[model samples]
Target: MKVGFDGKRATQNITGLGNYSRYLIRLLTKFHPHNQFLIYAITIPPPELAISEVEYRYPGKQLIKSYWRSFGIIKNLLRDNIDLFHGLSNEIPYSLKTAGIPTVVTIHDLIFIRYPQYYSFIDRLIYKYKYRYAALHADKVIAISKQTKQDLMHYFGVNEDKIEVIYQDCDVIFHQQVTSLMKDEIKKKYQLPEKYLLNVGTIEERKNLMLIAKALLRIDNIHLVVVGRETKYTLTVKQFIKQNQLSERVHFLHNVAHCDLPAIYQHAELLIYPSRFEGFGIPIVEALHSGIPVIAAKGSCLEEAGGPGSIYIDPDDDVELAKQVKGIIDNNETKMKMVRMGKQYLDNFKSKLISDQTIHLYQNVIDNAKR
Candidate 1:
C-alpha cells in the first residue's frame, strides 16, 4: 500500500502540530519499513526527505494548484494515484472524498472552538468552516488526547469510532543524561536562580501568563523562568511585572535551542504550565520523564497530560496557584512522591509504543477499506 502525508508543516522552527507531523513521519519510517510512504510537500515547504524506505515526494509548486485553501489540496488528491493520502494538519480538500481515495486527518485541538475570544471574527469563520470540512469529509480522524476526542464527539458530532485517540511522545533527545556539575553550569549560563519554576510555551493570553504572573507576585522565594517567543500579550505580562515591582522575580527567555531544553528541564525546581487550553502538554510529559515535578492548570487537556503525575491548580485563582507551588517546594516528601509517580505515568507515553499503535491504526484503516 502507498501512503502520503502532508509536507507543509515540515519547515524550520517546528513546534506543536509541526513537531507532531515530523515526529509521526520519522517514527512511521522507523517502525514500518516495508510500507511505501510518500511525504507530499509543496515548494519552499520542500520535500523528498527519506528515512530508510520512506520517500518524501514534494510535488513542487508547479504541479500543485495555485490557490491556498481546500481547492489546491483537492488538486493534489486528484493528481496523486495513491492508496491513502493523509492531511496531517486539520484542513482537507472538499474534493478528496469524491476522488475515490481514503484520507486521514489529525485534530490537535479545538482551541479555536472552545476559546473563540482569542481569534478575530474573520478567523473564527475560517476555523469553523475548515473544522466542519475536515470533520465531515475525512475518512478517519486522529485525536492527540482523549480530551480532544471527547471535544470532537461533543462539538462536531463526529462518529466516535471514526475518531481514534493517539497520544504524542516527547523528543527522544529530551531524556539526556547530564551530571550535577553540568546541570549547575547550565543554570549559571542562563543566570537562572538555583531554584526557579519553568514554563514553556508560546507567550499568549490563552496560555494564561497573566494568572501565572499574578501567582509569581505572591510567591517571594522562587523565580519564574519562562521559555517561549514573545508576543503582544507578553508585553502585558512585562508591563504587569514592572507595575507590580516584580522586575527581578518574573523572567522571560525566548528562541531557546532544542539541545539546551533537556538540561533546563532536569535542573529546574519544577515546571509550571498553566495554559487555559491545550491539545496535549508535551513539556509536562518531558518534565515528568525527567523526574521533575509538574504544576499545571486544572481544566482542559492539561489534566489529561498530568494524569496522576502532576499537581493541578486553577488558572484563574492566583492565591491557590501560588499556594500549590509553595506547598510542593516547602514539603520534600510531597515533591519526591510526585516525582516518582510522574516517572511511572511517563512509562505509558513512550515514542516507540505510540508509533506501533499508530501503525496498527493505519493498517486497520487500509485493510477495512480493502474489505
Candidate 2:
C-alpha cells in the first residue's frame, strides 16, 4: 500500500505533535517495510530529521502554503494514488473526502475546547473548525487516549464507533539506559542539581507549572529542573519563584537538545507533571520508559498514560502533590515499586503493538472504501 501522511508537523515541528508524527512514520516503516510511505509536507525538513526510506512530496508552485495544505493537496494526492492518508496531527485536508481518499486523523486532545481561557479567540475558532470537521468527516478518528475519544463525541458529536483509542509510544531512545559517565557529563553541561525533579513540556497555563512552584514551598531541599519552551506563562511562574525566593532551587533549561533528554531523565529523582489536561501525556510515558517514578495531575488522561504505578493528585491541591513527592523520595521501596510497575505497564505501549494496531486500522479503512 502507498500510504501518505500529513507531514506539516513532522517536517516543521521538533517536539510534541512533530515527534508523534515522526515516531509513527518510523514505527510503521520499520515494522512493515513491505508498504510504501510518503510524506506530503509544506516544506522539506532538515536532512538530519529525514526518514530512511519514506519519500517526501512538497507543493510545486502553490504560493499560498497554508491554502495548499488545506485544499490544494488534493491534486497531489490523486497523482500519487495514495491508498490511505493519515493526518498524524489533529486535522486533515478539508477536501480529502471530495477526493475520495481514505482518511484517518489523530486528535491528540480537545484542550482548546476544554480550556478556552488558555487560547486566543482566533486560535480557538480555527481549532474548533478544523478539528470538528476532521472528526466528523474522516473515515476514522484516532484518539490518543480514551479521554480524548469521549471529548470527540461530546464536543463534536462524532459517532463513538468511528473513533479508535490508540496510545502512542515515546522515542525508543528513552528506553535505552544512560550510562553513569553520560549522566555525569549531561548533568555538568546543563548545570542540573545533583538530585532534582524533572518537568517536561512547554511552560503554558494549561501545563500548570505554577502548581509545581507552589508545591516546592512545602518540600524542604528538593530541586526542580524544567525543560521546555517558554511562553508568557513562564513569566508568571518566574514571578512566583522570585516572590517566594525559590530561584536557587528551580532551574529552567530551554533549547535542550532532544538527544540529551534521556540522560536528563535518568538522573532525576522523579518526574512531576502537574498539567491541568492532556490528550495523552507523552512525557509521562517517556518518564515511565526512562525508569523513573511519575506524579501527574488527576482529572484527565494522565492516569491512563501513567498507569497504576504512578501517583495522581488533584491539580488544584499542591499540598497533596508535595506529600506524594515526599513519599516517593523518602522511601526507596516506594520509588522502586513505582518504577518496576511503570515498566510493566509500558509493555502495552510498545512500538510493535502500536504500529500493528495502526496498520490494521489503515487496512480496514482502505478495505471499506473499496467496498
Candidate 3:
C-alpha cells in the first residue's frame, strides 16, 4: 500500500520537530524497505518535475498549493492510490476525511497546558486549533513519552489506547566507546582542558541554562562547554558569565556539526542537563551510550531517562548542584559506577529496536483500519 507522510517540517523547522521528521522518515525507509511511501510537502512555486520514490514524494508548493494540498490536493493523493496518511508534526488538512484516508499524528508535548505564558498569543491560538484539534481527530496519536501520553489523555480527553508511547532513539553515531586518543584529539582541536563538563540544547529560560552556569561557577578546576545556536535568551547567560568573571572558564560552542559531537561527548568529564522541562531527554541517552556520566535535575524526564547512578539535583538549589558537581569531578569511582548503569539502559533505545517497534505499530494501525 502507498503511504502518505507530511514532510513540511523537514524544510521549515531546523530544531526539535524538524530533526524528529528527518530522523523518523529515515527510520521508516529502512525498516519498511519494501513499502511505497510518498512524502507530502508544501513549496512556493511548484517544482517543474515531481520526485517520486518508495521513500519520499514532493506533491506540490505555495499558498495556492497549500490550499490545494489541504482541499484540492486530496484529488492528487487519491490519484496516487494512497492507502493511509500520517502527519508527523501536526496540523493535518482536516480535508483528509474527504478522501476516506486515515490520519495519524504524533503529539510531542503539552508544555502549553501548564505554562501557557511561555507561548506567544498566536502560538497558543494555533496550537489550540491546528495541534490540539488534530490530536482529537486523528485516527491514532504517537506520544514521544509516557508523560506526554498522560498529558494528552488528561488535557485533550483522548482515549488511552488511541495514543501509543514511542520514545525517540538517540543519534545513530552516539555509542558507548570513543577511544582516549580520540577524546584527546578533540581536546587539542577545540583547546579543551582534560576536565570539563558538557551540556547541549537551547539556551532559554525554560532550559534553565542559568542554573548550569551557577553550578559551574562554584566548582573548581572545571569548565562548562555549551553547544547550540545562540538565542535572545542567551544574553542573560552571557551577561551572567561576564559579571561573575567566568568568561575565561565557561566556553560557548555555537553551531557544531552533528558528526563531531561524539568526540565532544567523550571529551566531557560529565554531561549536565538542568532543563526545567522536556517531552524527552535525548542527551542523557547520548551521554549514557557515550559512556559519560550524566548529572541532571530531579523531578523531570531526566529521572526517567537517567535511571540509577546518575547524579540528580534540585535544579533550583545552586548550592546542591555545586556540591554534586564537585563530588562527581573529584571521584573517579563514582563516574565509573554511573557509566556501567547507563550501558544497561541504552539497550532498550537502540535505533533498530525502537524503529522495528514503530514499524509494527504502523502495521497495527493499518490492520485495525481494515476491520
Candidate 4:
C-alpha cells in the first residue's frame, strides 16, 4: 500500500505538531515496513527527520506552498495513486473525497474554539472552517485524547462513531537510560541547580507558567528549570520572578537539543505541568517514562497522560500546588511509588500497540473503500 501524509509540519516544524507528525511517520515506517510511505511537503524534511525508507514529494514548480497543500496536493495524490491520505495535522485537501480517495485526519485539539481569547480572530475563523470540514468529511478522525474526541463532537457535531481516540508516545530516546555521567554533563552545561523541578512546554498564557512561579514562592530550597519556547507570557512570569526575588530559583532554557531532553528529565526531582488545558500532555508522558513523579493541572486530558499514580491540583491554586510539591519532596517512598505506577500505566501507549492500531485503522478504511 502507498500511504501519503500531509507533511508540512513534519518537514518544517521541530516541536509540538511537527513532533507528532514526524513521530507518527517514523513509527509507521519502522513497524509496518511492508507499506510504502510518502510525505508530501512544501519543503523537504530536515536531514534528522528524513527517513531513508520513505519518499518525499513536493510541488514541481508551484510557488504558492500553502495553496498547493490545501488544493493542488489532491492532483499529486491522484497522480501517485496514493491508496490513502492522512492529514497528520488538523486538515485534509478540500476535494479529496470528491476525487474518490479515502482520507483520515488527526485533530490535536479545539483549543482555539475552547479558548478564543488565546488566538487571533482570523486564526480562530480559519481553524474552525478547516477542522470542522475535516471532521465532517474524513473517513476517520484520530483524536489524540478522549477529551479532544469529545470536543470534536460537541463543537463540530461530528459523529462519535467516526472518531478514534489513539494516544501518542514520546520519542524512544526518553525510554533509554541516561547515565550519571551524561546527567552530570548536562547539569554542568546548563548550570542547573542540584535540586530543581522541571516544566516542559511553551511558556504561553494557556500553559499557565505563572502558577508554578507562584507556587515556587511558598516552597523552599528546590529551584525550577523551564525548558520550552518563550512567549509573551514568559516576560510576565519573569517580571513576577524578579519582583519576588526568584531570579536564582528559576532557570529558563530555550532551544535545548532534542537528544538532551531526556537527561534533563532524568535529573529533575519532579515535573510540574500547571497548564490550564491540553489535548494530551506529552511532557507528562515523557516524565513518566523518565521515572520522575509528575504534578499536573486538573480539568483536562493531563490525567489521561499522567495516569492514576501521578498527582494533580487545581491550575489556579498555587497553595495546593506548593503543598503537593512538598508532599512529594518529603516522601521518597511516595515519589518512587508514583514513578512505578506511571511506568506501568505506559503499557497503554507502547509504540508497537499504537503503530499496529494506526495500521489497522488504515487497512479498515481501505477495505471499506473497496466495498
Candidate with maximal TM-score: 4
Tens-digit per-residue lDDT, 92-183, candidate 4: 99899899999999999999988999999999999999999999999999999999999999999999999999999998999988999999
Give the winner by lDDT: 1 or 2.
Answer: 2
Ranking by TM-score: 4, 2, 1, 3
How many clashing residue pairs are found in candidate 1? 0
1-371: candidate 2 lDDT, tens digit per residue: 99999999998888889999999999999999999999999898998778878999999898799999998888899999999999989999987887899999999999999999988899999999999998998999999999999999999999999999989999999999999999999999999998899999999988999999999999998899999999998999999999999999999997898889999999999999999999899999999989999999999999999999999999999999999999999999999999999999998898899999999999999999999
What TM-score do all the candidates reach, one by one?
Answer: 0.92, 0.98, 0.91, 0.99
Q: Rate the local accuracy (lDDT) of all candidates.
A: 0.79, 0.94, 0.77, 0.94
Name every residue pair that clashes in candidate 3. 39-57, 43-61, 43-62, 68-73
**Pairs that collide, model 4:** none
Badly placed stretches (over 4 Å) of model 4 are: none
**What TM-score number comes out for model 2?**
0.98
Candidate 3 lDDT by residue in tens digits, 47-157: 322233334444554447667555665776788887778788866767776567777888888887667878898888878777788888788889888888888899889
Better of 1 and 4 by lDDT: 4
1-371: candidate 1 lDDT, tens digit per residue:
67877766754326776788878878887877677777655544424323445555544455433353345655555566677777787766668767777778888888888999899989989987887789768888989888889999999999999998888878777766767886787777777777788899999999988888898877878888899978899989999999998888777876677777888888788998989889999999888877888999877888778778688888889999889989889999999999999878876787788888877777787777778
Candidate 1 lowest-lDDT run of ten: 43-52
